[model samples]
Target: MEFKNVSVVKEANVYFDGKVTSRTVVFESGEKKTLGFMLEGDYKFNTDAEETMEILGGDMSVQLPGESEYTLYKKGESYVVPANASFEMTVDKYVDYCCSYKK
Candidate 1:
């Protein structure tokens, strides 16, 4: 997938001591997205807006809110996170992903 006519922020959103990083992309239609990658590690993310995370490459095991087990998602797969909720992810090696926010 690709985005056209979008503005990308130079400054990255760095997390977990830079284990996870992303750049914000603003579209002409006022939609926002972040393209990033995760290194081998476990992570937990909290969202203010609802988010759809698509795996671009590699894979991850995710535990959504209130879920006890992590579900594996490979490249080309996606998952949704509810607003004001949180999710956990386990990346074996690396994962390339795009996250779109719905406000």
Candidate 2:
């Protein structure tokens, strides 16, 4: 997907020792999103706002809040994480994703 008339943060939001990295993108309406990629590994992330994660490329196994097991999400798929919740992800190799936060 392409973003138009938006501002992107130069510095990345790096996590898991750089295994996961994302760049913040700010829209004209003050909506914010992160475009990022994850290398092969397991990761846990906590959310302050509700988030919709769209898989841009590759795939991931995600365990959402209160979920007992991981569910596979492939390219062109998306998942939501509730506000103030945490989730886990397992990336097989590399997964490209876009995360949009609900205000």
Predicted structure with the largest lDDT when compared to the true one: 2
Pairs that collide, model 2:
none
Quantify all predictions' global Cα lDDT against the true fold. 0.96, 0.96
What does candidate 1 score in Cα RMSD to the true structure? 0.8
- For candidate 2, the 10 contiguous residues with the lowest summed lDDT are 1-10
Q: Tens digits of per-residue lDDT for model 1 on 8-94?
A: 999999999998999999999899999999999999999999999999999999999989999999999999999999899999999
**Which prediction has the highest TM-score against the true structure?**
2
RMSD (Cα, Å) for all candidates, in order, is 0.8, 0.6
**Against the true structure, what is each candidate's TM-score?**
0.96, 0.98
Q: Give candidate 2 regions above 4 Å deviation.
A: none
lDDT of 2 by residue, 9-30 (tens): 9999999899999999999999
